[model samples]
Target: MYPLIYGGDARILEEVLEGTHPGLSSLKCRFCQINSLNPNLVKGKIVLCIGHRGGSEAAWSAFLAGAVGTVIVDGLQLPRDFSRIYPCLHLALVQAMVKELPTTSAQQGTGDNRIAEYNIESGTSMACPHATGAAAYIKSFHPTWSPAAIKSALMTTATPMSARRIRKPNLHMVQAISILVQNLRLVTGDHSVCSKAMNGTVWDLNYPSFALSIPYKESIARTFKRSVTNVGLPVSTYKATVIGAPKGLKINVKPNILSFTSIGQKLSFVLKVEGRIVKDMVSASLVWDDGLYK
Candidate 1:
């Protein structure tokens, strides 16, 4: 119902309906009248229902009756909203490939079937495994590193997403894994590479994403300290830059230039945010760019 929560599993319901009679006409029932329905007819077939009363309750009722799944043809229309519940592939070819996957055992019938070609679907479900795989790969090289360290590595290295310069950045795993591997040797060799003293808060843990909340009524200054372990060439320099800062907001990066003397050398910097009264939310980014890397 309502797009079936995007990735609702049809096989789960099919498994529940296994060995039960199929091809029975789907029954329509009120949300509260599901228990009164005849189980024999409801079992092993799709259930069609109206989602106006409650989508979740109706779906649960169908599940209890051993229905394969529920499809809501009509419901209360709601406002448009974006959800990160999962990722979606906008490509038509990918969507078509997914639809061709064998959903029933009958589709896979025959002995000694050696399949040479395959197609796949993409979503948060798909992305999650890739992220986990990246983490596992990093773990292979840094067997002694803790989970938090690996997570920090991934988060800190991910590419930032900017929408119309709105300053909202999402996770980019490819870039994250690249940076993780690039700095793996330095991180593994230095016990102090994952020090908590470097981060001012959980949000500032060299994370790939961050948010800053400033009270509107009072003028306040917030300082965040961050440190980076040099894994590149010895004696490298990086410059700090802030983008899309709001009016009346002053940002200062103490020692804006970071100079590293050797591999495994750690450098610290202070980010001070001073803002006056403001009515609207402000978004910005603090970036440290070496000539070759960001």
Candidate 2:
């Protein structure tokens, strides 16, 4: 949309531009936003916005500019607080449109008639709602649960996923996010995970996901601390196993067998994750199973 507008402007100037190139369209999509788009060019066209910022109001911005529609393209998860921030931006835009002061140089708007009635959203739109809703839903069930506990519960119970396909592109999709907050039980509160001291590696937290920040070209000798609670059978022993460890990596879990005498019993363990520094991405998993749960 913006590209066509730029080409038309260049042609009108009697300029013969050589080759195809993007001129500030990407920047506008990232930083400049609505102010970057001119009403003269985008009035009746669909605007293509590429990135998702924490404070971005891309959808509302396009609608206010009289764009007939908008398309949002993103590569990552949407910022969690986006839904809360959206209504404020929407109201502010309404106020601005109403108080179209002659003194303000900013193009007030095209008009009420040109406002877009529809929008198409992908990546960002599909992800944020689920996260926000999950947190809200969990809080509804356990109002006393701290934010950190809710966060840990969600992370711990999360299903492992990747965009990898079973067949070709769009043929077989990876399983979607399934957060079973109902099955999650918090042992206790530990705000250290949210504090600045636990800024880098969160391996010590009470969650299934493990992470270790190893600097490049440095020796790969790091230990992770983790805790687990028994939510299944009261009297059972679970064995720890590491899968998909890269070659040359040695992972040893201290006291790998966890025995629970009763439900809600919590146990802690240490993982001595040692490996040689490699250029490729390190992908692995630690599974705890008692021939029942994995």
Candidate 3:
């Protein structure tokens, strides 16, 4: 089942699964009701009563409401392929727009007029499903992966939002690469690295073969991966090391490796820094593929 729950609350999900509450076939109320005004006045018009970042949630809501499509004109486009991102998101906006938008000349007076009825309105909950859906898609592509591996790919591949005001995908495509490595572990069964290993050490990795700078007093962190193909590998193959981390600040890695190839597939990761530092930035780069392994 494609479960879609909020970031928190696992108990409610369990209850629903146990049949205490209605199963997948249940009522769903969505935010961002659509408004039908002059198309000329509001070119891509969909309305949300709540305030959110870039109105992204509301914009997608309208798509599901019954609009042909949605266009989030702020710094919030998918950081990756701008095309597929809209369809998934537009579902909400289309649903909202369909409900609020009146029948057109072509569909006028026909039995199809039920479009505005509650039966016609379409909706989904605002929860982690968005992330889960992405995760599911990854699993579908690479069925043999561990949970950690899948998570790594998604996080690493997540495109970083640009400074521009329009929404976009996450930029760090490293997530997928890391998940593949995690899968390698499942195959070799050489499991030596501890959970702490994913946390990684402080050193210069130089894996991607690029230059990065971490200013003095500034804490910085980066992730690496070993493999993501072949479904029998473990989820902890990629070893993490941190170097030149500034003082007063700490670097952290979540599920250090990318993807694993066992219970599930697809991978992602998160690198975060906390505390204060004197430097403005720190650099991390990949080790170049030279003749001998350095």
Off by over 4 Å in 2: 1-3, 7-32, 41-129, 132-150, 162-208
Q: Give all candidates' CA lDDT scores.
A: 0.55, 0.54, 0.39
Q: Write the per-residue lDDT of candidate 2 for residues 1-294, one digit (tens) a residue.
A: 333223122121112111233353434543215444555555666555554442235545655655555545455453322222211222221111222234432322344232222222234344467688899998998787677667867875687654242111332223322323333334243222322333555555555567666777466777878777676799999998988777778889888999999987989899887768575446677788899876
Superposed by TM-score, candidate 3 places the C-alpha of residue 124 at a distance from the truth, in angstroms, of 12
Tens-place lDDT per residue, model 3, 35-130, is 211123222333222222234443444434343333333233333111112223223322232323444321232233233322122224322456
Backbone clashes in each candidate structure, one number apiece? 1, 0, 111
Q: Worst ten-residue run, lDDT, model 1?
A: 79-88
* Candidate 1 similarity to native, TM-score: 0.48
The number of the candidate with the highest lDDT is 1
Evaluate model 3: give its TM-score: 0.25
TM-scores for candidates 1 onward, in order = 0.48, 0.52, 0.25
Badly placed stretches (over 4 Å) of model 3 are 1-127, 162-294
| Model 2 lDDT-worst window of ten | 9-18
Better of 1 and 3 by lDDT: 1
User: Of the candidates numbered 1 and 2, which has the greater TM-score value?
Assistant: 2
